[model samples]
Structures are given as C-alpha cells and as structure tokens.
Target: MSESAQQIGEKSQVILHFDLKLNDGSAVDSTRVNNKPAKMVMGDGSLTPNFEKCLLGLSVGDKKAFSINANDAFGMPNPDNIYHVDRTKFASDAELKEGMIMGFAQPDGSEVPGIIRSVAGHSVTVDFNHPLAGQDVIFDVEIIDVK
Candidate 1:
C-alpha cells in the first residue's frame, strides 16, 4: 500500500519494525532481526503509552527514533517479583543453571517465566522482572502500515 498521511490513533492497527536498544548501542530486542514486523493495536495497551505516543503523528512509511526512560518504558523492577523456589519444584530431569529461564505456573494457571539468579542447597532465586526494566532504551521504528 502507498504511504498515507493518516495520523495513528485509537483502533489503528499498526504494522511496523522496531529496534530496542540500550544507550550504548547494544540491542535489546528488534523486529528487524527477527524478520517479523510487529503488529499493535494503538489502544490495546500492548505498547506503553510513552512508546505509543511517539507514533501518534506518524504516517505510513515514516521512520522515527526516540528514547524513553526506564519508568516510561518498562517500569522499574520490583523486589516483590523475585521469589525463592524450592529446588524440588524443578523437573528432576531438567538442568538447573543460573541465568536459565523457566516457566512457572501460578495458582491461576497462568504461566510466568522466571530467570534463575542462583541455586544453593534446595533454594533457587528466580527474578520475574521484564528484563529491560530499570534501564533506559532507544526505540527506532519504521512504520510499515496503519489501518
């Protein structure tokens, strides 16, 4: 589709490529490398308000770069999200290694991924932070489509 002058707004379905990077130019996440452009509905809350606001006045095919603070991007990590789990909860046949991520089921049957921070004796420290939390990031985007 040819580029349109439409301003992104609520209910607009946007298809775009994004690169999330650290201030040091280290990439954190990118849809370009993954070769799968992302699709987001403007008002769905999938993209943080600050992130979405950057696209508000953009038109299709527009490329833009912006920075968002840690709190505005993925809020700071909360200590309460960290948990100490009994080693027994791990599958006996599975490897338990620090920095490894594992899926845990909550009482509500939802699965939450936890990253292992340490394993000592029968306790394993798992952090449930979003990973990019507490760090400022730069976002580069190429708007592919807006409908």
Candidate 2:
C-alpha cells in the first residue's frame, strides 16, 4: 500500500531507506544495512523539493527510486569558495590532512566549515564549498513507513 507524494505533507514523519550514486552509476552511500530506516518530515530542508516530490503520496512498505541533478543536490561549485590561510593557524601539534573539515570564523561573528585542500610550508589552502558541489547525484529511496 504505497501512498502518493501528495499524501506525504509537511510535518509528516516518514521512514525511508536511501541510496546515493554518481552519474557514472557508482554507488556512493546507502542505508540498507540491517534495514535501519531514517526518518524525516516532509517539506523540511533535509529532503530537496524534487526529491520529496518523488515521494508525494506513498504509503508504508513503499519503495521509490529517483535521481537529482547537481543543482538539486549539492549545487554547482563556486570559484570564490576557495581560501588560503596562514600555516600558523595550525597548532604545532596539529597535523594537516587533506580533505579534513575545519571551522573558520567570519567577520560577522559566525563560523563556517571548510576542507583542507593543500598544505604548504607557510600556507594552507582551504575550500569552503561542499565536497559534492558541482556534481550530479542519483538517489534511490524507499519509504519504509509514514506516520
């Protein structure tokens, strides 16, 4: 008994199994192990509109699969998202690892996360953009239950 996407509205708790893949048909992530279902509320930012649309009205024990483009997923990469920081920022005891996420403070008294791209003697290159930016992803989802 699968419900249509329209039946799954805002604030409705839904449990689903998700599988993510790249355009090359390579699997990236999945939640099928032990069938541990993930829950989410419709219309929440957790699931994109396009992705949610695919599950509009779906009853429990329903399985659905779909894909989202780069814009709908992680979005296109921005050139301005790259930044270089002084090597001194790293503590002497800290080891710089590429792809490591670090927090950066902004002038507005807020903090943002960035990933380490490269490490030079006196400079450390950090990329603030998301790791999946500029890439299209194919997501497969199954509605385990909707409450």
Top candidate when judged by TM-score against the true structure: 1
lDDT string for model 1 (1-147, tens) is: 444436687678999999999999999889988699999999898888899999987888789999999999998999999999898988888788999988889899999888899999999999999878899999999989888
Clashing pairs in model 1, backbone N/Cα/C closer than 3 A: none
lDDT of 2 by residue, 45-135 (tens): 7877777777776766666667788888878888799978898877888788998988878899899889999998889999989878888
Clashes of each: 0, 12
At residue 15, what lDDT does model 2 achieve? 85
What's the residue-level lDDT of 97 in candidate 2? Answer: 91
What global local distance difference test value does model 2 have? Answer: 0.80
Cα deviation at 18, candidate 2, in Å, is 0.4
Which residue runs of candidate 2 sit more than 4 Å off their true CA positions? 1-6, 103-112
C-alpha lDDT of all candidate models, in order:
0.89, 0.80
